[model samples]
Target: MQRVAIVGPGGAGKSTFAQALGERTDLPVVHLDRFFWRPGWVETPRDEWRQRQSELFAGDRWIADGNYGGTFDDRFALADTVIIVARPRLACVVSAVGRSARFHGKAVQAAGCPERFQMVFYRWIWNYDRDSRPRLDIALARHDHLDVVELSTRMSMTHFLESISVR
Candidate 1:
């Protein structure tokens, strides 16, 4: 599919999945986390963020991975397919902790935002499904015309990608 939008809670591997999908489909990949977070964990201004998102989504083919709550409509409007990586909470928590340990204080993107542990972030992950899913679902419901794929485990993501490779 062209113009894929990948979304999920932190540690859900949305970036990884976007890369894999981009490689398989020969689409450009955009990791929103890189642009959204400025150096030292600062956030890009809302107006700038939306403008950047618009430019990124204007592409003919792309795999953008991130959930910038306010820009769902922008991405969904241009995307032909939407994928949600909903791995289990425990798995997500463990993965996030490991990621922070590995990249702690190291700039992982052009924005120079280093990974760090924040109780607030963990809390968001812990309650993502119960708290954020409703909003996400509502957003998705607005784009019923787009193809939606729900992946809840690593195996499921793998299988989905493999299915694509086979095509």
Candidate 2:
């Protein structure tokens, strides 16, 4: 997959998977969340976000991680493969909690990090309800041209990674 997009609910390990895939394939990896979020967790304007995405996809090979509905069409058009990380809601919540702790502990100053009065773990877990998954489902359906690989369980994700031929 020359251009792969990793999609799924927040805290689903999409960023980690994208990083791993980028290492394995020796391709550039782009975290969509980083692009969408400005300093202090403020969202970048839609037009600006789209313009940045356009620049990233202009390259031939990249592994993009995160689901920004605003740029779905632009991203899908450039992606040859779509890897959906469909972990259970509970698992997603747990992961988010852990990630929030680790990220904050490290003091990784980034636009996406939750700032004053916003607890990352608490916010992320409660943010996505059942409606979010259906949105992702719709995105997959709409992008029929993409080779969709859905990993609904942790075991499946490991298996899928093992099956990929590391060039």
RMSD of each: 1.4, 2.5
Task: Tell how far residue 122 is off in model 1, in angstroms.
Answer: 0.8
Model 2 lDDT tens row, 16-52: 7888788777889988766777666777788888999
Q: What is the Cα root-mean-square deviation between model 2 and the actual structure?
A: 2.5
Superposition error at 22 for model 2 (Å)? 1.1
1-167 in candidate 1: lDDT tens per residue? 88899998888999888888888878889999888887778888988998999987887888898977778888898899999999999888888889989988887754577778888998999999998888889889999889999999999999998899532
Give the top-scoring candidate (lDDT). Answer: 1
- Please identify model 2 stretches exceeding 4 Å from their true place: 105-129
**What is the lDDT for 162 in model 2?**
76
